[model samples]
Target: MKIQYFIPAMIYSLAFALQASANHPGSNLDDVMSEKETFFQAINEPDAPSFELINAQGELKKLADYEDKIVVLNFIFSNCAGVCPLHSARIADIQEKINSTPMKRLVQFISITTDPGNDVGSTLEEYGQTHGLDPINWEFLTKKADDPEDFTRKLAMEYGVKFQPEEAGQQMHGVVTFIIDRGSRFAAKFHGLKFKPINLILYVNGLSHQEKKQKQSFLVRWWEVIYYYFIH
Candidate 1:
């Protein structure tokens, strides 16, 4: 896939700081390294939660259903007249730039509704249609209304997204996106305000290439031959 690249200010800022502090301790660079390392750990960790959600078609789908592909997931309610629309539009812009990749192979986008009570299957369908989402790959989902609280909590904890509900159906939450690699690892997190689809694709493509190389190491090749040569 032809990956789109867009370097944002924050990336250059953090990277420069980390580069300066790579080998020095008890220096200003150390603090920058610590912060960058913390961010890296948060993104590169192996655990990515998979949950059941009702898709726009009213069918059950799991995050695992899209295994072996780069997945971008975000949480937003259809009723959200605030940040949700802008975030979705930003994602659409990114998709347009990376139009060469196959929808199923290179990327999949999912939006999970925090306001499950109102964002039903039909509602999600309407929302996707309203946003001009490419139904071939993009999906809007709502958790079952019966005790959506548990699912909501699971989603928040799994993706490290914070969703706070308020009276009159208003929510105070950050616009966050999670990128899951082909191996289903939490590869990156994009704060809503800082989320740029091209940047996400570039970083995820880097991770995908890295994982592919790691799988082809000599140790992996030897183990694979030992484990499967006799059977096949």
Candidate 2:
């Protein structure tokens, strides 16, 4: 075949292969949707719960502030010596991958402290630095003074997470990472420290461009079938 000669199936197959090589984006197909469901619990509520807090730099940060970008939300305490560190590392890993993709600018990473009392000021900043979180698009936040102190702790509760103080100022809490869409709607959650970071990254990649009609399409991976039937 001449290089100038091309067919619809060939072009579609090439484009689909390129996309598959990168991050798998939004899919309306039941199998893909079901796979996402098996990995992250969906919370497509009318409105996601909101919060008001300050980042490590003392800048005001809120849920509404990121209404235009997909938000990856997590909970951690500066003093945590167990799963929290692992959780932050997981986020860092996910961040590195997201940074390598176009979705990096389309996403915001937020870590809310469950122990706001000790996770403030330079302490939070140092924690992020130690974990290699770039401050450009990432923030380590806690409750501001005169904000009831327990503001973030209770906020975690609203996200269905709980934290109990332990010896040496550490905390015992559930490990979960949440995803919120551009419209401020809670999308899904990658629970525990074991969920693949790539899954969340791909999930965010999908949500970053997902639309109503795309989510209602007959098959999101129809090109796979196309290539299989036409080329194979």
Name the best candidate (by TM-score). 2
Runs in model 1 lying further than 4 Å from the true structure: 1-42, 102-104, 210-232
Model 1 per-residue lDDT tens digits across residues 1-232? 1212322332233222222111111122222223433332235556578787787677888878887667878888877868989888877666554444423246788888888778875787888777867776788877764654647646875677677778888777777777776667666676755533534544443333332333224323432342243212
* lDDT value for model 1: 0.59
- Going through the candidates in the order shown, the clash numbers are 1, 0
| Candidate 2 structure lDDT | 0.70
Residue 32's C-alpha lDDT in candidate 2? 52
Go through the candidates in order and give each one's C-alpha lDDT.
0.59, 0.70
Model 1 poorest 10 in a row by lDDT: 19-28
